[model samples]
Target: MSTHTPGEDVPVRRIDRILAFMSLGLLVLSIVCFFAIMIGSASGADMSGGVWPLIGVVVYIAPIVAFALMLAVLIMSFVRRARANRGG
Candidate 1:
């Protein structure tokens, strides 16, 4: 790492922050939904109506989208680091 002071660090790109936050939000949502489903099942609550189907869809889809977003963030981060190193 460079010896730059805290106030002089490399700036994070706006898109990178957005992608990272999106990934984090989706991941948290999926985990919450997964646990909700588990608790609902364990308590023998009805799983056939209301928010169950929506929760099920979120459980299935959120992780995949989160993973994709994380991958994108990683790629962008790497690219930015590489460019910085090369130019410096």
Candidate 2:
């Protein structure tokens, strides 16, 4: 290990499991909404002929993407820690 002190640049932190869990839940919900809207658009009703459906899709994607990105960061952090422990 180089002579760099841990707290100098990378500060110690706590992993908020509750926040992680909530993010995962939101991500799942958004994904479900995305698919639901997509299918509904493809099917009958033909609401607004399509404009409204596209708009709905955009609205749903934001939250889901945000949650997914947060999850990815958590996963990556875990993997990195594991690798460090194993001297990889």
Candidate 3:
């Protein structure tokens, strides 16, 4: 029989979980903003003619930032796993 305890199977770190939640939140926000921009443009709401357009640009960048954060978390998790395997 396996000797591992229940708690020992949890491989994800707390920080990783936090980062994941943050990434999810950013994804949701990006989706909402995308739809908003699409609907606004379709309705001839001047999406590209005012301050709202600047806000749209910021919203568009959120997913990119989220991706970078997730990539960092993945790299960190890999490094952690490697160190653990090395018995350090």
Candidate 4:
């Protein structure tokens, strides 16, 4: 026999929900910064006002992807919790 706790996988009761939300917010922040950096890069050259390829790209790519992942998991947890609560 297997035993389980109530709201074990539930988003409302899980810490991941908070983490996911935080991740999403941070990702959004990164995105905003990314555009700014990219525009700044576009304007000039490295030695003469160019964008830093490594830093700018990382700024854009990492947060967006991370936030998506976090949001996905958070949603899943919430749905799972709702389903369990409903005895579905």
lDDT of 4 by residue, 1-88 (tens): 4476673644354566667676777777677767777677688646234445655666767786776778777687767777787778
Candidate 2: C-alpha lDDT: 0.62
Which one is best on TM-score? 1
TM-score, predicted candidate 1 vs. hidden true structure: 0.78
Query: lDDT tens digits, residues 1-88, model 3?
Result: 7554333432788899999889889888888888887788788886657767766876878899899889989898878876765557
lDDT of each: 0.88, 0.62, 0.79, 0.68
lDDT of 2 by residue, 2-86 (tens): 6644333322244545556667776676667677667776886566665656657655776866667677767766666666555
- What is the descending lDDT order? 1, 3, 4, 2
The numbered model that scores best in lDDT is: 1
lDDT of 4: 0.68
The local lDDT score (0 to 100) that residue 34 gets in candidate 4 is 74
TM-score of 3: 0.75
lDDT value, residue 45 of candidate 2: 51
Q: How accurate is candidate 3 locally (lDDT)?
A: 0.79
Write one digit per residue (lDDT tens) for candidate 1, span 1-64: 8664334335788998999899899999999999999999999989999999999999999999
